[model samples]
Target: MRRLVLTSLLLAIVVIGLGAYTRLTHAGLGCPDWPTCYGLIDVPETSIQIAAAEQAFPERHVEPAKAWNEMIHRYFAGSLGLLIAVIAFVSIKLRFSKSSKVRYPIFLPLCILGIVTFQAALGMWTVTLKLMPIVVMGHLLGGFTTLCLLFLLYLRINARRINTQGEKLAESQLKKYSSYALIGITILTAQIALGGWTSSNYAAMSCVELPICQGDWLSDLSFEQSFDLIPPNQESYEFGHLAHNERVTIHVSHRFGAIITGAFLAWLAITIFLKAKTPSIKNTATILLSLLVIQISLGVSNIWFSLPLKVAVAHNLVAAGLMLSLIALTYKLRQNSEESLYE
Candidate 1:
């Protein structure tokens, strides 16, 4: 079960990276179909295969490179699903074993499996829906959430193993900061969602300048259109009508959210360093602070350089890492608090 959990964690990380790459390269709709690329197991490259693909997807031209990118993402996602399924089964088996050290309920692994299945559906809709902003953002969030849950499960399992051997921490060291850390997680999640929305709507290029948007602290913007999730009746999978002002609304809102999230995290890190009793807690805090800095730098570079592909993709990846760090810090605090109950 440990091996399975570790495998899933690594694969989940790859999926996140590949997902970001696909989106950055505009390959979300590269296949124009789900579970297959141009109606084949792989992208069509030969003349014969290209002709067949063109015939089948007449309206969608065959781009071999983009199609391969999407298919690779799908394949990795499918492999991750299999790993999670194994985890669910093994965990359920361990639940009945009196000798097992695992403390988490069987339901957690099962829940992750269910989430992976739902994520698969979202992946399909991402293509069939023509990269609709809402669905795309949801897909991105779902991927991150899956990774977060799996990582937490890994930590819980290992911590439980250590505790079973009587090595658990003895005091409620981070009790005072627990709630604040959780609140920081919530705000960071919202900021990530805003980032997803901005990316999906192609709003990142709206300003190209940092502190101010379009050379103005405030500009004419439309929140309604910017946040619109309603799609037209037409089957065409294209971006909904969005004016420059609406895009600006999304871009600026994401910027504001970043400011709030960054400030809160900075305060949380300082407090942790000064008050945390354990080296593990202090190290997690330090890592979180470092990731926060890198994430901010990526965000700025993305804009300053007019959304270069590599920087943009790194921004998305670092955002995931930031979430993982917060999840770890908060989970550790909870574990310590629980352990203090007996002493």
Candidate 2:
């Protein structure tokens, strides 16, 4: 079970990296459609082949770079799907048969499977529709949500089977900490969503100066243009688009959100340090704080250097990693309290 958990965690991390690669390389349209690349199971091989396919659908404007990026992401995603399916299936086989009480073990993974499938579909639509911001944000959120569910499943599967000899009741106060962690997770998730929105909508460069969007110290910004549902282009929907409004709109929000998330994480870290004597809980807070600092650095760098692909992708990967770390931390907290209760 420990091995399984470790494997799942590694696979999830790989998925995060691949996702970053897809965006950094601007390959969201590499495959051009979900579950398939250029209407094939795998990406096309030659320039002629790509040209022929592009000729078939000239309006969609398929580019080789984007196609490969999208296709590779899908390939990795497909691999993850197969892996999780195996995990869920084997879990069912091992933990349940005729009268096992572990009926819910399969439920969480199954839900993840279903959601990933939907997310795969959304990925296709995101490209075909020419990178709609809302859909892309939805896809990003779905991907992170999938990560959380997988971690939960991994934790549940690795739960130690202990013989309780007149176990005492667990402290209900543990639930309070769980609630606090839940709040942190919620806030972090929202920040991730905004990050995706800022990325998909090309809002990252909206405020290049940073800390102060639009080169001002807290200007009265107009989200009317900032919140445009469509992906901002070099033309159309003018007015501070890329040259002015773009950096002003996105950088500030993204930076502010990171600070908020980091602040909450800091508070959580202090709480754990003071009250959570368990090694696992304390280590979780430490990991959480470490990731928070890294994430903040990535965000600022993305702006300072003008949103390079590598930096942007690293930013996204770190966000996903941060989420995974939090999930593990949450489960570790649960494990600590459970052991204390049952001890």
Candidate 3:
């Protein structure tokens, strides 16, 4: 079960990265259909096939490259979903078995199954609704949530092994710092949502110049339409339908959010490093700090390099890393607290 959870966790990262790549390449609507690309099991490759696909969906021409990108993401996501289902089944089996000595979490796997089902729905809506910002953002959040949950499950299943291997910390120290770690996770999650909203609305490139947006961004900033849950109806939100001002507002907000999130997480990391009684805890803090630095660098590189594809994808991946690192810290702190209670 541990091995399965780890596999699922890694695959979740791949699915997220592929999803980012697909969106960045403007391939969200490449299929123009749910689950299938151009009404076929795979992308229409042959000239005849492409012609048929284009004929059926006259509004959407066949772009083999983009269609393949979308399909590849779907394939991986489908596999991950299946793997989660298996994990849930195995968990249940283990829970009911008379010979089993270890207790496994049945509820978490079942909850993951539910989330994956909803994620599938969001995936369909992302295409059917023509890349609606809310749906896209929801899908992005769903992916992140799924990944975090799997990481949590992994930590739970390995609690004994982890606790035995690590140098113990005083319960008082960890309990005092756990709240800070929790706050750091909360801040990071909100920043990631801001990122998702910015990307979904095609605002990532709205602010070309760093430090701030274009000339007079403050005067032009308007939240009226930028954060609307229900945007006006449109045939397609392919590139983006929002005005330049709205996009600028989103981009600038994300920039500011990054600054705030970075500052808070930096403080938490430093505090943990200084207060940690064990090398394991100290190393976790060091890793968290390093990820923050890398994530910030990637954010800057996105602007400096004009949002290069690789840099943008790396940014998303690093964000996931940051999330997992914080989660690990929180889990370790709580685990130590529990152990201290028994001791």
Candidate 4:
């Protein structure tokens, strides 16, 4: 079960990476259909198949390369889903087995199973909704949520093993750090959501200048349209709507969010390093600081380079990595707290 949980986490990371790749390559609508590529099991190969696909979905031409990118991502996601299901089933089975420890509840798996199912629906809507910004952002959030849940499960399983080995930190100290970690995670989550909104709305390059938007402290901004979820069918959102001001609003807001998130995390890391006695706590804080620097650098690179594909994808990857590092910190602190209570 532990191995399955670990495998699921790795697969979740892969799914996130592939999703980023597909989005960056503008292949979200590669298939123009859900769960299938060109109305076939795979990308259209022969000339006849390509012609048939074009005939069937005239609006969506067959781009074998992009279609393959989308299909491969879907395949990996489906595999991850199946693996999660198996983890859930095996977890439940173990609870009833003769050597059952019953230390872990079946509810966590059940919850993750449900989340994965909903994530699949979000994935379909991302394509079927004509790349609606709202749906695309939702899909991105769903993927990250899945990764976080799987990471938590992995931590819980390991916590049990660690407790059995009688390794524990001071409960008072662990609790203090755990609280700060929780606060940091909450801020980072909001930051990531803002990032999703910015990317889905194609607003990353809205303000090409750095440290400011449109070379001014104030500009024409429309919060309503910027955050608007509904789009008219008449408007071709292929490159996104012509709401130039709204895109700037999103871009500016994300920048402000980055400042707040970065400040909070910096404070948290320093506090941990200066006050914590445990080597694990100190080491995690060091890693957290390193990731924070890298993430900010990537964000800057995205702007300086005008949202280059590789840089944008790397930005997404680093954001996910930062979240996981914080999660690990929280998990470690919680583990110490649990063991402290047992002792």
Q: Each model's TM-score, in the order given?
A: 0.94, 0.83, 0.97, 0.94
Residue 181's lDDT in candidate 3: 86
- Top candidate when judged by TM-score against the true structure: 3
Candidate 4: list runs displaced more than 4 Å: 234-236, 336-343
The lDDT, on a scale of 0 to 1, for candidate 3 is 0.91
Candidate 1 overall lDDT versus native: 0.84
Scored against the true structure, residue 250 in model 4 reaches a CA lDDT of 91
Question: Taking the tens digit of each residue's C-alpha lDDT, what string does model 2 give over 106-205?
Answer: 6676787798888878877776665676777888888888888877766565554421333222233444677778888899998998887776766666
Query: Higher-TM-score candidate among 2 and 3?
Result: 3
Off by over 4 Å in 3: 337-343
Indicate the TM-score of model 3. 0.97
RMSD of each: 2.5, 4.3, 1.9, 2.1
Ranking by TM-score: 3, 4, 1, 2
Q: Where does candidate 1 have its weakest 10-residue lDDT segment?
A: 334-343
Of the candidates shown, which would achieve the greatest lDDT relative to the real structure?
3
Residue 28 in candidate 3, Cα distance off native in Å: 0.5
